[model samples]
Target: MSVDPEDIEPTYRWPVPPAGGWTADDLDRLPNLPPHTELIDGMLAFVSPQTMFHSRAIDFFTWHLHSLAPQGLEVVREFTIDIDCHNRPEPDVLVVDEAAILGMEQTRFPAESVLLAIEVVSPDSVARDRSLKPAKYAGAGIPHFWRVENADGRAVVYVYELDPATRGYGAAGIFHARLKVDVPFPIDLDLNEITAKRRRAE
Candidate 1:
């Protein structure tokens, strides 16, 4: 018998304020959860069920990223990055050096090793993905960020590159049909292939 993920409830919950807040160590003590749970600013946030289009977008980008990643870097999906004591975000896709993750024992990947972080927006995660994550990733010194959003049944890739002097990302470009970026690595992606058509209800 298989348990439905939706039927399962989180085993742990953060204590209310006035009580001590949750830490990265506290998060690590919890048992494994369904892949959709994330720690944001010391609070646990549950991601809602993803649309088929969202899953396809992640898969599509992961495939192309893996194929075109720089020689020593690898692309990973739904991986946790330990940003600080209070924040551990699992990006939809991230790029890291192959050597940096070798023989790692920690449950979360170190932010220092991350090269690029990408988030594909879901309705439930719109605010966190668009606002919270971008600020946090830049502050952690991650060099690149990409946000994939659905616009009229198509994928729109928004690219950003970090400026060392300012410690913030500068918008590179936004692509509709095709995504092309030269920093970190060269990438050319077709948005059409990754987008899924919404099905009508019976």
Candidate 2:
């Protein structure tokens, strides 16, 4: 069920970006840009459709983060962080200050308000999840980041903490079955739940 990236050009009429490429604010104004479209270095980066593993992993993190996060922190999914004039990439899940709750109408969070940003790696976004986006988040001073990948159909999370001295992230740990962290707040989770389907309420 995966379409070749080259095939999109023939079947889709993408919005024309402006001179010097699209800005962060332009994400709201552009018509025809697909949902979850991101601005990277002033260029639009379209994402592939989600797999069930992606959705389940997001739910697992969102639910646990919501239940355990300290006061004045909130968990949000698929919201863009306004990094600067030209870059606005959306993380799959984010933890931000309660101040980021500007209102129900708020469309994006400022990068400074983000405490932790997490990306569940998609087959199409492996490069961004592993490198590009993390560098951008680090440059904006977001304190923590986690990249989750499917390893033999299980979620394997790579945890990172920002190093202000270098403006880059340092690896904290890699969790195959359990995720335990103390920075930003204490959090312990059973990573296996990401692969287990939630029972439908009948």
Top-scoring candidate (TM-score): 2
Task: Report every candidate's CA lDDT.
Answer: 0.84, 0.93
Model 1 segments more than 4 A misplaced: 1-18, 104-106, 196-202
lDDT of 1 by residue, 28-136 (tens): 6666555656778888777888897789988997898899987889888888888998888899998998876766564668999999999999998899988899999
Task: Give per-residue CA lDDT, model 2, range 57-81, as digits (tens).
Answer: 9988999999999999999999999
**Candidate 2 local Cα displacement, residue 37, angstroms:** 0.9
Candidate 1 global CA lDDT score:
0.84
Q: How accurate is candidate 2 locally (lDDT)?
A: 0.93
Segments of candidate 2 deviating more than 4 angstroms: 1-12, 197-202
Per-residue lDDT, model 1, residue 54, is 88
Q: Residue 7's C-alpha lDDT in candidate 2? A: 80
Give model 1's TM-score versus the native structure. Answer: 0.85
The TM-scores, one per candidate, come to 0.85, 0.91
